[model samples]
Target: MPKLMNVRVTTMDAELEFAIQQTTTGKQLFDQVVKTIGLREVWFFGLQYVDSKGDLTWIKLYKKNEPNNCAGQIMQKLFQPNELEIYPTKVMSQDVKKENPLQFKFRAKFYPEDVAEELIQDITLRLFYLQVKNAILSDEIYCPPETSVLLASYAVQARHGDYDKTTHAPGFLSNDRLLPQRVLDQHKMSKDEWESSITTWWNEHKGMPREDAMMEYLKIAQDLEMYGVNYFEIKNKKGTELWLGVDALGVNIYEKDDKLTPKIGFPWSEIRNISFNDKKFIIKPIDKKAPDFVFFAARIKINKRILALCMGNHELYMRRRKPDTIDVQQMKAQAREEKIAKQQQREKLQLEIAARERAERKYQEFEERLKAMTEDLAKREQDLQNAEDKIRALEEQVKLQQQAREELEARQNELQEMMIRLEESKNLEAAERQKLEDEIRAKQEEVKRIQTEIEIKNEHTRRLEMEVEEARQKKEEANRQLLAVSTTPQHHHVEENDHDENDDLPNGDVTKDLEIDSSIVDPVEERRTLAEKNERLQDQLKALKQDLAQSLDETKETAMDKIHRENVRVGRDKYKTLREIRKGNTKRRVDQFENM
Candidate 1:
C-alpha cells in the first residue's frame, strides 16, 4: 500500500487538506486543487511552496522527461524551455510523516497585460484583487502617495460599500491599514488628514458596486510602474548589482538603487535564447551585432526561478499575439453579458430610488398646501360670523323704515318718473354701444382685407424679383460672350462685317449673322424689359407698404376713437348716477317731512 501523506492548500479565503499518496506528483495536487475550487482559467494560477533551501518556489506540475510531442517541441522552441519540466515533480518526500501536512499556497502566478480584457470571472478578479491588495499593504508593491490614496479609496469603497459621514468617522480608518506604511511615512500627513483625503476620493465613487470598485482598483493598480513585476537580485558581467524584472512584456534590468525605472530592457521578441549554468545566466540577443546579456544570481535556485519566469512570460507574450482561444472568447462574452446585466440592475435600482424621492417631494408639497387651505378656511369662518351679525342689524333697520315708507308714496311716484327717464337714457346708451361695436367689427374686417392684399402683393413682387435676377444673369452671360467675340482676331470681325454687307452671301451665313444679332439684341431688350418690370415691382411694393402704413394708422385711429367713446360713455354714466343721487336726496327729504 502506498503511504498516505497529508497536504494543506491555502486559497485566498479558505484552506483545504488533502490526503494523498506520498509518491503523488505536483500535477496531481494542482489538478485536485483547481477541481475543488472550480476554476476554469487554470493557466493564471499555480501552487507555491517553500523549498528546502528556504526560497519560495512554484511547484512543478509535470514530469522531467515527458514525451517530446510535436506541440511540446514547438512550445519548447518558441519559449526556449520546456516550462512543464521545470517544476518539482514529486509533491511529498518519503521521509515526511503522514501526520505532518505540507503547506502550499494557491496564488495568481501569471498576470495578463489588461485586467479588463483578460480577467473574465468574478472569482478570478476577486482573487487577483485580493492578491494585489495584499501586495500593496505589505509594501511588496511600491506606490506613490497620491496613487496610494486613490487606491485606498477604492478599497474603502469596495469593503464599506460607500462612504458615510456618520459611520466612517475620523477614527474609522485608524484601525484599517489601507495604504502601505512607506507611503504614509513619505507623505508625513496626519492620520485625520489622510482619512479626509481618502474619504473625499471615496465620495466620488458613490454608486459603484463592490465588484466594480474592485475592478477599478485593479485597473489603476495595473498601471503602476512596478505592477506585475517579479524582481530578483542579480549581478551583471561588470560585477555590479542590478535588479532583474520579469513581466508580461519582457525582461528588464534595473539599477540597485532605483527600481522605479528600468536601465535596460530586452523584449521577448528580441531575445534569441535564455540559458543558465550554475550561478550564471545568459540572454542571447536576436540581433547578432548586439552583445549577449549575462548576469549572475546568488543561488542556482534563483536562476531556476528566473528561467521559469522568463519562459512563462515569453510563452504568454507569444500566445497573446495570436488570436484568443475558444474558451477565452466565450469567457469574454459571458463576462460582458454579466457586466451589462449588473449595470442594468444598478440603473433600475437607481431609477426606483429617484422615483420614490420624487413621490416623497410631491407628498410634502401636498401636505403644505393642505395646511395653508385649513388656515384660510378658519379665517373665512370668522368673516362669515361677522356677516351674519350685520344681517341681523339690517333686519332691525328694515322694520323701523316700514312706517315712513307709505307716507313717502308721492315722492316715490315722482322717483318712478325719474327712473323711467333713466331707463330711456340707458336704452340709448345700449344702442350707441351696439353701433360702436358694429363699426369696430367693420374696421377690423377692412384691416384684415388690407393685410391679405399686402401678402398677395408681396408674393407677386418676389416673383418679379426672381425674373429680374434671371434676366440679369442672362445679360451678364451675353456681355461675356460679346467681349470674347470682340477679343477674337480682327479678320474675323471684318469677315462678319463683310458678311453683313454682302446680300449675295449664302443663306446659312445670313441665318448665322441673324442668330448672332438676335442673341446680342435679345439680352439688351430683355434687360430693359426686366429693369422696367423690376421698377414697377418696386413701385408696387412701395405703394403696398404705404397702404399698409395707412391701414395701420387707421387702425390706431379707430382704437383711439374707441377709447374716446368709452370715456364719453363713462362720463354719461357718471352724470346719470349724479342725477339719480340728487333725486334720491330729494325723495329722502320728502320722507323726512312725512315723518315729521
Candidate 2:
C-alpha cells in the first residue's frame, strides 16, 4: 500500500490527580486504586501500538485502508466512529512493532466505578498542593508581575514589577524567611504584610471599630479552606483583634477539646513552654513521616493586603470551642447551584453552536445537491449520446437484415419455379433413376445400423442396472439389520419408540402421492403430473374414508405411541432451539464396534 503524508502524532496526559496517595507505577497502581474504590465490572477495548515515525496510521485499521491480511480485524473490535480517526494511527503504529527508544506520554482516563460521583473539592485540593510543590522545586510555575496581588507582602517591598503602594527599597520586609533579606528587598511588599498592618489598625480602634471586621476576617479564612488554602487560624472571637500571619507549614489553632480546657494541636506537643517572639514558626515534624495534617502554611494575606509575618504557637490561655468546619449538605447545594448555572451557560452556547452547525450542514447539503444535479445532467447528456449511437447501429442492422430477407425471398421463388418444372416433367434419365435408388438404399442401411446398436445398448444397460440395484437393496437391508441389532440394547430402555413411520407415514396423502410418483422421478415433467393425479385420487379416497369413519374421528392418539414409530420426523426448524441438539446425547452416548 502506498503511504500518505497526512498523519498527526501528539501526546496527551491524563489530567486527573491521584484518587489516593499512591506511588505512580504500572497497571497495578490503577488496578489497586480501582479495586480500593470498588468497581464491579471493567472492560477495556483499544488498539495499543506505537508508530516508529511518530505518525499514527490508525486509518489502516479500517476495511478500506486495511492491507489484505489483518486489516479491519481491529476496527471491527472497537467500532467507534471516532475510531476512524485513529485507524491511520494504528497502521503507523505497526512501524513501532520493534522497540523504539522514543516514548510517548499519554493521558489517563477514568471510567469510575458504578455510582461514583466527582469529588471535585477533594481532587482539586490535592492537585493544587502538588502543583505548588512542583513549582517550588522546578521554579517554572509562575513569575507574576509585581502588581500581582500575591506580591504585596510587607516582607518584600517594591523593588520592581507592579505593587502600587511601596518604594524601591534597600530594606527587606522582616518576615520573609525563605529568601535572603537582600533578595527580599528586591521585590515589593507582599499582600499579607500590608493586611497585617490594617488588622493592627483595626485592633487599636477595637472600641470604635467601623464594622464587624474581625468576624468577617474569620469567615474569609474559613472560605479560603474551600479554595485549596490549608493554613488557617482562629482569633478568639473575643481575644486577638485580628493578627494575620503566615507560618512555615505549622499552625497552632487555640482551642479546647471535649474537656473545655485549652488543647492545642502543634508540631511540638511535648514542649513544656514555647513562645514566638519573632513570629516565625518552622514546623519540624517528629513522627516517622511527615504528619498527615494539612501542612497548613503556604501563603497569607491580611485585610486584603500583604504581610511578612510567620506564626507559631505562643503558649497562651484559650477557651472552649465548638465549631462546624464544613457543611456537607450546604456545600452540595451550592455546588448544585453553580452546576446549574454553568449548564445554562453551556446550553445557550451549545444552542448557538448547534444552530451554526445546522446552517453549515444545510449549506454543505445544498452544495452536494447542486453537484449531484450537475452530475445527473452530465449523465443524461451522455445517455442521449449513447442512444443516438445505438439507433444508428440498429438502422444499419435493419438494412442488412432487409437485404438478406429480400435475397432469401428471391431464392425461395426460384426454388418454387424449379420444383414446379420438375413435378410437371415426370420423365427421368436412366442414369438419374439409378443414382436415386442407390442413394435411398444407402440411407436405409445407415438407419438400420443405428437402430440395431441403440436397441442392443438399451437392453444391456437396463439388465445390468437391475442386477446392481437388487444387490444394493440387499446389502442396504443387511446393513440396516446389523445396525438395528447393535442398537437393540439401547432401544430396550425406550422399547416403544421403534417403528418405521419415516418410511410408512406422511402428512395426509402427501406420502402416498410421493411414493406413487417416485417411479417417474427420472423425468421431471412426468413426475409432477403423476404426483398431481395421485393427489386427486387420494383426496377422493380420503373423503370416502372420512365419511365412513366420522363416528370414530374423535379418538385421541397417545404421544408415546407416536414416538414408538421411531422413524419420526426430525425437523430443521427444531435445530433453532438448542435443546433439540441436546436430544442427540443418547445417540452420541451409544457406541458400537464393527469389524469385518
Candidate 3:
C-alpha cells in the first residue's frame, strides 16, 4: 500500500508510531503530531533527527529525507529503527525527581549552542548577547564575576568593531562607562591603568575578529563543546544529583560532583538504536561485543519524553560527527622562544605607538586653535565690510537728500517769481475791468434815452395819422354837399352865385384851412430816424456787455492762476523742510549702525 514505512514519532512527553510514505516531509509529520495532540503554537515547533556522525540535525521541510526512503530494510534508517521528535524551538530539559515538574529552563552556558553553527560568530555572538542580556535583565540567570569580565570584554568589542593594537581604546571604553561605578571602584584600576590593560588584551587577539573571539571565549567559560544542546538533571539510586548533557556529541553524563567533568560518554558511535518507557532509558550500541546500557532515575522519576529527547540527540550526534583519527603534538623549546620574542616585539611596538599618539594629539590641538583664530579674523573682516557698506549707503542717502533739497529750493524760487507776475497781472485786469464797467454803464444810459425817444416818436406819428384821416373825411363830406346843391335846384343856383361872390372874398378862409391841412404832416419820417438811433444804441450796448463779460472772465482766470501759484510755492517750501528732517533722521540711524 503505497510503499509505506514504519516511522516512530517522539515528543517531550511520549513516543508513538505512524505508518507513512518515505517521501513524507517533516512539515507533514509535524502537522499530524500537532493535530493529534492538540498542540498549541505549532509554528514554534520542529522535528530534529540525529545523524550517523552523532550530530543533531534539523529536518528542513522543503528537502527530501533520504533515510526515510528505505522500507523493510535491515539498515538503521531514520524511520525503520530510529525515531524523529517534535520539539519546541528551545528544547526543554526536565529534572526528574520527586515527580518534579518539567520546566523550560535553559542554562546560560548553553546559550550560544542554540544558534546555528554555520553562522559567523559576529552574527551568532549578537544573538547570544541579546539572549544573555535579556536573561540577566529578567533575573532568570545571574552572571558570575568571571562571566561578567567576559561579558564586558565582548561588549567592548561589539561596540567598537574588531580590535586593533595600533589604535588606543576609545574614550567610551573607560572603566566608568563600561562597568558600574561600584564595580570600577572595586577593581581599583585608574583610568590610565584600565586603558592600558584593555589595550594589551585587545592586542593579543590577532587571529580572529573580536566577535569570533568573544563567542569562542564565552563557550569556553560555559564549558560547552557544541551548539544546539539540552541539559537534564537526574539522580542515581543513591539520590546523588547528576547532570546529563545531550548535544550533537551524543549523551554526556556527569560522574563526579563537579558538573563540568563527564564520567561516562556515549558518542553514538557504538549506539545502534534507542527506546524508552516511562523512567527507563535503554541505549543499543552498534558494536555486537558491547552490551546495551540501561539507565534509571526512578527516584527522580524522569519523564519518558526526556528519554526520547536524549535518544534524538544521541542519534543526531552519531550521524553528524563521524569518528576520525586526530594527531596530538607538544610545543618544542624553539616554538616557545619564538612566541616570547613575538610578545616582546608587540609590547615594544605598543610603546612607540603610544608616544606617537600623544604627539598627534598635541598637534591636533594646535591646529584647532589656529583654525579658531582664523575664523575670528574672518568674522572681524566681515564686520568691517558691513560697516563700510553702511557708511556708503548713508553717504548715498545724504547725496540724494542734498539733490532733492536743491530741486525743491529751485521750484520754490520759480513759484515765487510766478506769484509776483500773477499779482501784477491781477492788478492790471482789475483796472481794465473797472473801465469796462464804467463804459457799459454809459452805453446803457444812452440806450435807455434812445429807446424813450423812439417810443415818443411812435406816439406822435400815430396821432398825426388820425388827424390826416379826419381831414380826408371832412373834404369828402364837403364835396358831396356841394354836388347836391348844384344838382338840386334853386338853392344850389343861389349858392353858386354866392360862391362867385365869395370866390373873390374867400381868400382868407381858404388860406386858413390849407394851412391847417399842411400843419397835419406825417410823423413817420421822424419815427424812422428815432428807430435807427435806438437800433445803433442797442448794438453798442451789446458790444459793451460782451467786453465786460470778457474782462470778468479774464480776471477770474488771473485770480485762479495767482492762487495756484501761491499753493505751489507753499507746497515746495514744505516738501523741502520735510526732506531736510528726513535727512537728519537718516544721519542719526547711520551713526547708530556704525556704533553697533
Maximum-lDDT candidate:
1
The per-model lDDT (C-alpha) reads 0.68, 0.32, 0.45
Clashes of each: 2, 44, 24
In terms of TM-score, the best-performing candidate is: 1
Off by over 4 Å in 3: 1-117, 120-125, 128-151, 162-229, 236-241, 298-302, 318-596
State the lDDT of candidate 1 residue by residue for 269-297, as single tens digits.
Answer: 77777777778887766666655577889
Q: Cα miss at 572, model 1 (Å)?
A: 96
How displaced is residue 82 in candidate 3, in Å?
A: 6.8
Candidate 2 lDDT score at position 57: 20
Error of 2 at 5 (Å): 55
TM-score attained by model 1: 0.58
Q: Compose the digit string of candidate 3's lDDT tens values, residues 137-248.
A: 3323323222334444555665564566446435546633443333233343466655554544444443334454555445433432222345566655445566665654
Which sequence of candidate numbers ranks them by lDDT, best first? Answer: 1, 3, 2
Listed in order, each prediction's TM-score against the native is 0.58, 0.21, 0.32
- Residue pairs clashing in model 1 are 60-87, 60-88
Candidate 2 regions off by >4 Å? 1-275, 278-307, 310-359, 378-397, 423-596
TM-score of 3: 0.32
Clashes of 2: 44
Candidate 3 or 1, higher lDDT:
1
Candidate 1: what lDDT?
Answer: 0.68
